[model samples]
Target: MSSDASSPLAEPAPAAGGGGRLVLGCTPIGNPGDASPRLLAALAGADVVAAEDTRRLHRLCAALGVTPAGRVTSYHEHNEDTRTADLVAAVQAGHTVLLVTDAGMPSVSDPGYRLVRACGEAGLAVTALPGPSAVLTALALSGLPSDRFAFEGFAPRKPGERARAFAGLADERRTLVFFESPHRTAATLQAMAEGFGAERPAAVCRELTKTYEEVVRAPLGELAAWAAEREVRGEVCLVVAGAPAATGGDADPAALVREVLLRVEDGERLKDAAAAVAQRSGVAKRELYDLAVRRRAE
Candidate 1:
């Protein structure tokens, strides 16, 4: 037997033992079954529930048999700037504000960053209820290296910009993850192939955790061709393997230092440039940074 909307689950109570805290609740990406008991409780008892989409929140509540005993308001990109102040005010008034998005955690390619930042600046407590994340889910399902991965929320829509973005990360050693629209998946994959090379290993995870979920893993060129041949639908995540490790010789500190310098000249910070080049080139970050600094001193 499955629990329904009218089941005898205990009514959830408001968060206790905290003062003026903002609770960032992560919602299910697809399956309602992924909703946590604590999430249901938070929904039922928060003083103010700020959701990216109120209709979706209601649907989730109906599925979970939860009746939010709180004021529900819209908090999306359009109104995030104006609403951040109001939501922060509610927290300042000692109310538990539950922030949720249509899917996944707030502020991951979604709204809620402003409100969270406001709360932090106001010295109000802010915490999260971790839950399903499409990034991690797709990465895990991608069969790509999860040990070191980067979640770049969404790719740029334009062809030129998107290609440039991929070019920037072309040397990134850590596996790269990105979100894309269903309609643009094929085009994006094609652009990726152009930037990252046609033979690079990649995966396209579609409709994750939902019916008709699909994971297509292959070289960038093959994935691009596959996507073009079909009408790809549903939420999409792309995971691309990192650049292959350097072979045939020992790691070159000088080359690594020069790579870091080149990245820095391209507007990246020295530390960030060094870290990124080190990862892709298999050079120690500390050693690379020291060499770059010494070169700068020369």
Candidate 2:
């Protein structure tokens, strides 16, 4: 059951003694204007403000022009494990503990999961003031299918591991999103090209909502080539179209392979041509791609 959108927000019945609860607030991903009014109230009212970076929390407060009337403390990955118990105890002791990350919601590829779990297990009251998110922001901006999507946070750093990971998702039918750094963006894109097929449609979103925001939509191979040519910078959100649905039709394998090869000869990359034909003819993409490449070499 969900609340009606038109209904006024109802305040939850406070834990015994009128307080002792955990509040997870989302900071702005990039822009300060996205901060919600409830978030502003939480920032100024919570008894204890636990931030991924206390300095950044201060910066955000400065930008929002609201000073927190609480004890500011650090709660990041390195200290989350050690500090979880204390934060939980604070909530139990009638303290309003607000957990915030540097940007976006905590525990989504960030800290706060352990504390949230601990608080939940202790049967303490916990809530969130939702705001901005990079995953949804990038997905909406990518112009890709949004109904179904998967967020693969930060592609594996190692080459072999990353390749295997991408290979595992090669046949996925839902759109895929990944977080990547500027320096590794080119290499990661190239690897995705090889694993998911060269022509798979994708978009590289950079510095979302920031002053120099940029989004480049193209095939995986072309994006890879573009990244390789220059130094890609800023935060990167890579969104790739999923593999086409398998039709399970009785399309002749030989005929499909020939069709793929014809497109290849018509100047399309072999993988791209194979994927396009596979989607339409219900042929196995990798099989058709392999056959086309082999025939082309011959």
Candidate 3:
């Protein structure tokens, strides 16, 4: 493939009467080979290329053997607010504006949402060139339930916020996915163990698609210990098994009472804890609340 800016893959100019459109290009998370052909064409042909990092965009282009013919500008968190209007204006002027982030799709825990929303509100056409995603990759590699899951993005950085977030999801039945910095992986895993339960099955996926890609599968407690024992490196994704299905009327009353007490010990109000546990176990919330109160007294 020619690295020339005028490569044949570049699309021809839009028709005279056609209004311009906003194209979201999904970049490779790790390996450059993951770049889609559509992404390459968009980079070469778009009139304005808005990138999270122009240098990284050039690096990707270099690796893909292509040169962007368009004008490239930085469009990241810091500049997103200021740049949205200009980018939208470019599109309105009948110029194709391509948005690319450092990795993965733009607007996913990255810059681009504001621009997209602005464009949408202006009645401009918006489209995406979907490609690599760490969320799907990690979930598939997790060997856990993929049929249904929730993407929690990144866990809260503050200790109290993180605890409350995890506690709120304790009874979530769908599998959960999370992203965390390499430095905080151990600490986050420890918190997950504390909030989700020590024996909850989970996977720690890091450096996905790169040379050192590693996915550690084990109980949350074990993963926490593993992270603590070594220096974790690279971007990390966490996939955790959700709460087990409620056993309905067959559930052990004693076990349910114990579960309620655990939540109370974690600082949840007795009534709130009982209601949450009751909903998960298919028990009457009022009965569960009374039983928990009596158990506390005992």
Candidate 4:
């Protein structure tokens, strides 16, 4: 079968219609070769193809040499709210609707969640054709432990919001994964170094499966410095090592006090800082605060 999207090719016979189904098709993240045969078949046979970016979807179809027979429609963040109902309606009319994003699986930091929810609430049959995924790929490539991990889609754009976001995950014991733009990668790493500890190990995976792919593994502090010195580009994935296992014994009161003071210097209220450090370190806030006061006197 010639896989040229523009080339004329015989279409497969449509499946016997009972009721319409919603199919979530995963696309290649970088390399087109990662696209699966099942994905191609689904794309070619769907009654309506809803894509995050119609242009990118066309490019993918051209690259794969398989043109979709269904009407292609835009279904992105800007119009997802309105387009979702129409897509669901198509499925309700006994037409197979395929949902795809520019890359990876739909609804993974991508559009399609609303439509998926609608399909489920309507009791429509939904299925998926899985393929390339940047999250799993980066986690596997990252030297960090991946036995257990969490994916935080993107850090907040503003510095304070981003810092607070990191602060909430400061004590996450399992490995952490995040998607960051090239421009914000450095700043995010810096915030992470402060919130999670400067010496916390992390890996920055860039342009996975592409020609210029790079995976840099280092402590959060070092990565922050490296990012500061150069222009980092491409799709970036950050895999950070989790917090160190807490000792059963109480944390040193002096160390906890110093941490609280540092947070205070960073503009956090002293009491709130003490509470935060106490909760994270398993030390009593009142004891730590009294120790800090006495130390200040000396």
List lDDT for all candidates, in order.
Answer: 0.84, 0.83, 0.86, 0.83
lDDT over C-alpha atoms for residue 55 of model 2 = 79
Which residue pairs does candidate 3 place in steric collision? none
**Please, what are the lDDT tens digits per residue for candidate 2 over residues 11-42?**
33234466799999998988999999999999
Q: For candidate 1, report its TM-score.
A: 0.79
Residues 141-244 of candidate 4 have per-residue lDDT tens digits of: 99888899999999999887777677668768999999999999999999988778788999999999899999999999999999999999999999999887
Residue 120 in candidate 1 has what lDDT? Answer: 95
Using lDDT as the measure, name the better of candidate 3 and candidate 4.
Answer: 3
Candidate 3 local lDDT, 14-119, one digit each (tens): 5246678899999999999999999989888887788888778888989999877667777888777667887788788788988999989998888989999999
Itemize residue pairs with steric clashes in candidate 1: none
Q: How accurate is candidate 2 locally (lDDT)?
A: 0.83
Off by over 4 Å in 1: 1-18, 246-298
Candidate 3 residue-wise lDDT at 277: 83
On the 0 to 100 scale, the lDDT of residue 52 in model 4 is 84
| Per-residue lDDT of candidate 1, residues 10-41 (tens digit) | 22234466477899999999999999999998
TM-score of 2: 0.79
Best by lDDT: 3
Better of 1 and 3 by TM-score: 3
Error of 2 at 28 (Å): 0.6
